[model samples]
Target: MAGNDVEAEKPAHSLFDNLQGLAFGVIMVSFGISLLKAQGLITGQAAGVAFLISYSGGIEFGLVFFVVNLPFYVLAALRIGWGFTLRSLACVASISVLTSLAPRLFSYAHVEPFSGAVVAGLCVGIGSIGLFRHGASGGGVGILAYYIQQRTGFRAGWLQLLLDAVIFTAAAFVLPGWGVLVSMVGALALNLLVAVNHRGDWYIAR
Candidate 1:
């Protein structure tokens, strides 16, 4: 009876709650991505790949980000659920649109690379937590990381850090040595923030 009462106190989120939460998450992430673009920096995970392609090909980051995430939806559906997959799809699409519109919305005159990286990391980390709490994600590596954590008791942030290391190394070929190092700082900040805060026990809302 006590367990039931405890569970009852933590009710699931309503549709409106989820919509707002997801919208907030998308806005935060898109802002972070815009910061990175402004600084000519790359992040980790699937977004990193998209950034690389956009930088090299002179293409739009939003289009590349959206396209790169397509394959991951299949994995998300198979491993998670259709509901989760759909929510994630919506999140990814919103980010794409927001990021595409970011340039016109605001422009940065000057932002130090290191400071910008740290701020961008914090933005993405907090935004991602919101998405996860609402039972959605940014798709791609986020889906994989969440699945691994749920299945193996591993930390999703740590797994992403490992994957980010690989992406950072590859970044050396595309970015200058100094740029790669600075990018690493951002990735570390983002992943560490997620690792420290994204605990299942800490948040009860589903």
Candidate 2:
């Protein structure tokens, strides 16, 4: 490996930097999720599950997402450590707050579903890179997936794909067929960005 790469892997981000990363990343994700929700679309993993529950019960997305993540914190604390667990909690809390406030804070004058999907994917995907680099996660399936991957070399990609399939299948029943299909496009975009950028061998100033 290059010296720069090795160095990049070693330096830790400052507290301010991590806080900035968590704040910005969570905001981006919250915006993306808000757009998806407005369109009756769903992504993958825990967020997707939260969306399903929220839609079915007419509950706020923030509340549903927060409640759904309760169990995952145990896994995060046990597997990742207190620092990671705390940071992840902060990220999730930011998401819950930002998502709850986004709709009220801004109005979407023109929201094309397909465009919303693309935007959501790009924003969340790119933002997630920042969050992960700062040693924080958006909680839910991400924490569980990492914990499982640590125990077994089963790869997070496969696990995410399976979860996406399950989420989409569930969406097919509750959401419009078109909404479910379009949601897949956004999910693909998001995952593709993550796959391309979030490499362990890449820059890792965590």
Candidate 3:
């Protein structure tokens, strides 16, 4: 009877968690897109390059997002287990599709740059935690960071910082120089929140 109760509860709990992840993922993607529209900031990643291309060429950001992530899905499968990779892929799909559609429905104009940066970072960070709890992520630099952590001992956060540095450095030419700094600050906030909160031994989630 106890085992039966546990089994029944498990699926319910999983459904709840997935719904929560989906909700947060929507907010995170929306926040990111809003930041881009408001700040003209390019995030440091393949996504950043995609944003730059989209901004300059008038391409849809979501299509650019999906294209940029295609190659990394293979790397994710090779490094992480298939299940983790698939879940991450799902997250990427949700984010990309919603990112594309949400902007069409909503206006993100008139947000102050500094306020938007901080709020956007917090939204992305909290949303990332929600996705990570469900075995998923936003899946850009995070994918590369995961692969690096698998092959080398460097922490995923550190690798992410390095990658962001290079990517944002290149971004100087693509955006106003100061926008690069704001984007870097946003990345720092997001990455810091992830590094601090996501410890394997801290939470006994089953």
**TM-scores across all candidates?**
0.95, 0.90, 0.81
Off by over 4 Å in 3: 1-13, 147-154
The per-residue C-alpha lDDT of model 3 at residue 188 equals 81
Top TM-score hit: 1
Model 2, 1-206: lDDT tens per residue?
A: 69777776587878898778888888888888888877778888789999999999999989899889989898888878888788889889889998899888877777888888989978877777677777777858877766665567565545666778988999898898899988998988887777666665566565
Task: Work out candidate 2's RMSD over C-alphas.
Answer: 2.7
Query: Between candidates 1 and 3, which one is better according to lDDT?
Result: 1
TM-score of 3: 0.81
Model 1, which residues run further than 4 Å from truth?
A: 1-9
Q: Write the per-residue lDDT of candidate 1 for residues 1-206, one digit (tens) a residue.
A: 99778878986988999999998889999999899988899999888999889988999999999999999989889988999899999999999999999999989999999999999988988888888888888859998998888788798899999999888888988899888888889888999999999898788876
- Clash totals in order: 0, 0, 0
Kindly give the stretch of ten consecutive residues in candidate 1 with the minimal lDDT sum. 3-12
Segments of candidate 2 deviating more than 4 angstroms: 1-9, 148-158
TM-score of 2: 0.90
Per-residue C-alpha lDDT of model 3 across residues 26-125, encoded as one tens digit per residue: 5785567666655677665566777778877899887887788888888777777787687777777777787777666777658777667767776776
Local distance difference test, candidate 3: 0.70
The best-first sequence of candidates by TM-score reads 1, 2, 3
User: Model 2 misses residue 64 by how many Å?
Assistant: 0.4
